[model samples]
Target: MDGKKKNLTTSWGAPVGDNQNSMTAGARGPVLIQDVHLLEKLAHFNRERVPERVVHAKGAGAHGYFEVTNDLTQYTKADFLSEVGKTTPMFIRFSTVAGELGSADTVRDPRGFAVKFYTEEGNYDLVGNNTPVFFIRDAIKFPDFIHTQKRHPKTHLKNPNAVWDFWSLSPESLHQVTILMSDRGIPATFRHMHGFGSHTFKWVNEDGDAVWVKYHFKTEQGVKNLTEEVATKIAGENPDYHTEDLFNAIGNGDHPEWTLYVQIMPIEHAETYRFDPFDVTKVWSQKDYPLIELGKMVLNKNPENYFAEVEQATFSPGSFVPGIEASPDKMLQGRLFAYSDAHRYRVGANHNALPINRPRNEANTYQRDGQMRFDGNSGDSVYYEPNSQSGPTESHQNKQTGFPVSGVAENIPYDHNDHYTQPGDLYRLMSDDERERLVNNVVGAMKPVESDEIKLRQIKHFYKADPDYGERVAKGLSLPVPQNV
Candidate 1:
């Protein structure tokens, strides 16, 4: 060997005697077990891929800081929203809910708008979607609802018959179904659409008084959507158009931004409210609960590495700081556990330690090692709580006040199942040209169902929303217009 030293080595840095051939009795013979280098290489490669997210598998993410422009300390004790000009580092992931990891970005689907804030207290994740409402109120039908969105088991392809069949059976899906079939279903770009924390959340003040709230992140770039023709053309031309646009925009110093706003309702209001406050399928009318300006979110920086940052980043609705807490929304309640479970499976139990998911400040918790213990294993500290020794302790100042829930702990039915009124209102709100486009879009999507039964069933739900809306769609599709349903 030269003085500089020259030698072949294995992945573990062990000196390898021979790399060109495996340990075998004869040339081109079967490999031997002693070929540990080969075994290690193949084994690691085999397990390299983690589980893909069941929803929002295709996404792009970035790192930025949320600067508090207004003082909301009286409304929320969340450290990030404490003082004027105070800034907290945040990570945001934009995604499509109904597509696989390799799916096209311009497809007709709701985009996921998830954010994780690294605060002095801990990481607070605001997990929401681009739309203000969901298809169903209760969480029990989530799996079934998603099944209809995905490919059929038998044909292994997206079946409109299956989709329409499911939607017709569940009248509660009319509102979201209408939205999905409209022009807004396919966003022109990620930067042009708004985001919402669809579930009703609770906000506790420093005085331990609470109010029901919902988040709305209005795009500062303005609300713009692609027409069905435009979206379809773009999808075919470039599957990753949205992802490329975001990354390139940030790269060129053109950061996309959104104005943060919230709609607050008093705790007492929910008790005597006309509609169920916690229903994810419904929205609080602006006439009722007006919006309050919070701050702004500007995506000024792109991720350093897609796999290290974007792919590994996780956000859970359960991850709340001092002021934020959950509401009685059944969908939100289910997500409190499900989101973290998804992260654990996709990343690992110690996913919080990952740079993208980890907090800026030191994390103190009783939870210990699992897979991938990268820390000094807590450095011989006491794992159990309530110890005399100085370990981590809970802050009484950060405790949230719980609201009263007085229903029997059984399979209670959803109180607000009237789903047509809002969709009807939405239809009537559209301009004449927009209404024609919406109807045409609905008819175009429904016409290819290849099943008259499924077509009529879905059309009936449209009739329930508005007779004019149903007649226009039925006329376009050449289907029998239901006189009355």
Candidate 2:
């Protein structure tokens, strides 16, 4: 039927040798900046949708404050966390991962939980999701992974074939996929779900000592969710149910609250940890490193103007203060660039100049005018640095923590690629009814995958995670169990 197979190439017709992993300095690395292909793919993905976010397009936001209850100066030198009872004004945006700006609120999707703190040092954003882990580890696969989640190019509609095929091929998605199909997948309300700084980050103290940390925002309202049937009904009946609930709650003075906690890991522990601590797809067991209470976050006021306060508001993982910094999470590393770039493209070149995104303290930069340069473009002062005229200077305290990289720069897969253990452990932790519901949800989704091979391949992942999980879903889908999987 065919004399030869045509090779896949880039937009410029350059042959793509590898389509999976991104180039990095070491096995567990901070993604290298020189990976042009990875950059090109992500940069292109960021701009695909015009005037709206390519992801996390549908969202709700509120005004809040984070109040420190205990001293953490020994762990982080961030001014907001400097003393007991210190409070910092903040804004939080909750969103659905794969939906458009007009999509239903109650759909089964990952909820984005991003917070921007107006600290004296600058605007520090803790951008993450409801779940602690994500579907993929490397940034190179992000564009492709999202493409599978979105509409098919040809049909312009959601395709189960693309979704399950990608998930089955990439077993690293098991942990998050399982969570997505669980009872908590469709939250009853935004206030009822937990939020996480899904990526590991570094918290450096005054002495330059660093510790790897993960952030968790436990909902004071308690965990609540909806079933597929109930959620679907609500989606049809009231598409703005979640949005209305949030706005009404604050208006009635029933303020929503969450307690912030962090799990701190020794900087040296990354070298000897069981799994790559830097991998965003994996989680550090709470048993290994317990949570320490940091602060309380309370949302008391809804945004007055949806377009100005909520829609125009931007949060980027790259916006860091002195003590808080990015870890080597490849997904996080890629996001640092993509988020800011997206904001610049969507919001404008001077997006940061927007009141919602601007720092509480004045910001002065030598870089001048672009689109939406509404404020004084440095007020006719010398725009060039190192000028004889008085000008703002860099802060030495903002220096990054030093770490060594020794491995060859290439597309290196993680050394410890045991993707099943955690999902297996997660499946076993649920009660009988919870497990039943999870299996039912997964089966319903997998039932429409269209390819027997894809279904069988994915079943192997379920089997590896838990025999009962595999058997139940297999029976529900009426598919034969794969042998020796």
Q: Which is the leading candidate under lDDT?
A: 2
Candidate 1 lDDT, tens digit per residue, 53-100?
Answer: 899999999878788777767777787898888888898999999889
Clashing residue pairs in candidate 2 (N, C-alpha, C atoms within 3 angstroms): none
lDDT of 2 by residue, 1-485 (tens): 58898998887889988889998889988899988788999999996544988999999999989999978799999988999999999999999999889999999999999999999989999999999999999888999999998998898999999999999999999999999999989999999999999999999999999999999999999999999999999999998888888999999999999999999999999999999999888999999999999999999988888888888989999999999999888999999999999999899889888889999998888878898698878787888888888788877767888988898889887787889999999999999999999999999898878898999899999999988888888888899876798
Per-residue error for 62 in candidate 1, Å, reads 0.8
lDDT of 1 at 318: 95
Q: Which stretches of candidate 1 lie over 4 Å from their true place?
A: 1-11, 15-32
Candidate 2's error at 156, in angstroms?
Answer: 1.6
Candidate 1, residue 265: lDDT: 94
- Each candidate structure's count of clashing pairs: 0, 0
TM-score of each: 0.94, 0.89
